[model samples]
Target: MDNSVLRHDMVDGLEESLDRFPDAVSVAMRSVPRHEFVTDGPYQNRPTEHRKTNTTILAPTAVGRLLSALAVEPDHDVLVVGAGVGYTAAVIAEIVGDSNVHAVDITRTLVYEARENLQRAGYEGVLVDCRDGADGLPEYAPFDRILVEASAVKPPRRLLAQLADGGRLVMPMGVGEQTLVAIEDGDVAEKFGPLSFKPLLVDGEQTGSIVRNRTKREDPEYEGRGWHAGHGWEQDWIDWEAHH
Candidate 1:
């Protein structure tokens, strides 16, 4: 398939999935070139499956759905973690304008590729950095919105502290079956539903403390059973034991 045709198909599929927020997200999706942010080898070899091949550009539907949940405004300052090849940042930059998008990735190669891709796509406003996604960019702290492209067992406190009051942190949380969590304010967090994502990694390591604490908190056999139940699904029931 031609790059243009593939781009159109992905955007169309994204539009369909993001029907809930048609006006806000679809316009952004249409404006960004999804192909530019993906690996050229994947783009050329498997044009149709390029996005998935490198796990760089997220599926259009997923990006659209997450963007809809973000409710980004034109003036909002957004921080993106696990920026991959910068496709999400580019799309978000289109929606909120480039000046408001700050993106970071842990891998040096990914960070370099993301910067090049964003530049090639004319999304110069996005600041790509090689850093720990869990720690976040403190120099540009107090963001109006933060989006984590990877999954975590719990919200990273370092990242949460960066959000402005009433700001939303959209991230996938859980062990096996991830749930999209939208945390508002630094104190209280809300779970949307079951979601799946590539686990967020820092220095090529999973969030050890966050996962352990969360597991114990959500364990049905734990002393805090009532509290765990009120928090929703029995997180301990997950197959974490199998791997451990």
Candidate 2:
């Protein structure tokens, strides 16, 4: 199948489900060649996980919703955390000028590959750095928009501080029940649909560790005694009270 056709189908699928895709975000999605960003995958409306790190290039539907929610302007300074393979950054660069986009990842190898991929995708100006996603690129602080690809229980203070006045930040919030949140002025102003993403690592372990082992107790299926009885049951809260 032709890649362009696939791209159109992917975008069309997202539009059908989402009800709308903003003009700017739609244009960006159409412009970038997502196939170039991944070595092998369906490249439709599903995630393409990297074998080594388990970091995924989010599905077109998810990326469309996120970029649409972000509302990135052509001149806005944007920061993207966990820039796996530079696909999201390239899309953002297509919306904002490439020079206006900065992306960071804790995995050094991923950063290198992302930089190369961005260049290959003709987004050479998008800065790709190896750093903890929690840091939010202080050198490029005061970004007009910040997008975190990882999930966290709460917004990182440093990332929140880096948002320009009246700027927007979007990310998956919560360790157990993650939701896409749009933050403004240090507060979660809006919450979107549920999401599942790897937890953001703040240790700055630049060693390019592919696997960040999470506590087995966090998984609800772990022997059935784990916290949080699956999603939205609030069972974890009751368990916590009992333990206390």
How would you encode candidate 1's per-residue C-alpha lDDT over 1-244 as one tens digit per residue?
Answer: 7776766666666555544665757677767776676545322323222333234456556676677777788889999998887888988898788989999876676777789989999998789998878889999988999999887767888888999988999988776667787888754366656657766664523322244434444543664544232222223344557866
Q: Rate the local accuracy (lDDT) of all candidates.
A: 0.71, 0.79
Backbone clashes, each candidate:
1, 0
Task: Write one digit per residue (lDDT tens) for candidate 2, span 1-244.
Answer: 8888888787777778885479888878888998778867646577877867757778888888788778898899999988888999999999889999999988877898999989998999999998878777999888999998887777788888999999999988885778998999888898778878767764422345432222223443652654332222111322443655
Question: Considering every candidate listed, which one attains the maximal lDDT?
Answer: 2
Which regions of candidate 1 are displaced past 4 Å?
1-6, 39-56, 187-191, 204-244
Clashing pairs in 1: 178-195
- TM-scores for every predicted model: 0.74, 0.84
In candidate 1 the C-alpha lDDT for residue 20 amounts to 60
User: Which residue pairs of candidate 2 clash?
Assistant: none
